[model samples]
Target: MFVIITYDVGEKRVNKVCKKLREYLTWTQNSVFEGEITKSLLMKCLNEIDQIIDEDEDSIYIYEVANPKNIKKQVFGQEKNFDELFL
Candidate 1:
């Protein structure tokens, strides 16, 4: 599965979340990451993130693409080519 993860986290805990995510995903933007990960690994990642974030102060969004080959991505400006990185 291909996953895109983004977070709005408190300043104090942002680095912790980012560091953990980088261990399993590719950092794509300021607080956005994307990569291919197994379902089990995805669950593990989420569990780890849950531990670091404050529920009321932080928010994490995960977009999962079960069939990446069927999706088309259009890039503008200087965005990195995620297709090349994740496909």
Candidate 2:
């Protein structure tokens, strides 16, 4: 599955959440992450995030597509490509 995850987390937990997500997805932009992940991996990722976030103060949104080919994105401004690697 292809997942796009966006989150609004309290300041204190931001780094923890971001770091966890980076392990399973690409950081598409600030507080935004997207990538193809297995169901088990996604579950594990969310479980880790759940442990890091305060349920009362944080929120995470996930959008999923069964097929990656169906994703059609349009960016009006500068686009971020987090998939690039730097050595």
Candidate 3:
């Protein structure tokens, strides 16, 4: 599946979190990172990431692009361009 993981991380932790994800993600674009990974592995990565993030200032949005029909599965701001597909 195609996974698009976006993060709002503290400036201090952004580099660290990006470093971790770099090991798995590819085809990076701006602050948006994309990769192909399974559900279980993605969850594992997210769990590990949660440990490293500062809850007070950092947040994450992990999108699992599996079922194209499920609009709620989309990450924030993504639906605007995809309204025709899911609306």
User: How many clashes (backbone atoms < 3 Å, residues ≥3 apart in a chain or on different chains) does model 3 have?
Assistant: 0
- TM-score, model 1 to reference: 0.86
Tens digits of per-residue lDDT, candidate 3, 1-87, equal 878888888888887887677666752544566768877878788888988998888888877778544544434553333223334
After superposition, candidate 1 runs with Cα above 4 Å error: 81-87
Candidate 1, residue 35: CA error in Å? 0.8
lDDT tens digits by residue: candidate 1, 1-87 = 999999999999999999899889888777999889999999999999999999999999999999989779776788863435656
Off by over 4 Å in 3: 67-87
Best by TM-score: 2
Q: Going through the candidates in order, what is the number of backbone clashes in each?
A: 0, 0, 0
CA lDDT, every prediction? 0.89, 0.92, 0.70
The model with the greatest lDDT is 2
For model 1, give the 10-residue run with minimal summed lDDT.
78-87
Clashing pairs in 3: none
Full-model lDDT, candidate 2: 0.92
TM-score, prediction 3: 0.69
RMSD of each: 3.9, 1.5, 8.1
TM-score to native of every candidate shown: 0.86, 0.91, 0.69
lDDT of 3: 0.70
Candidate 1 clashing pairs? none
Candidates sorted on lDDT, descending? 2, 1, 3
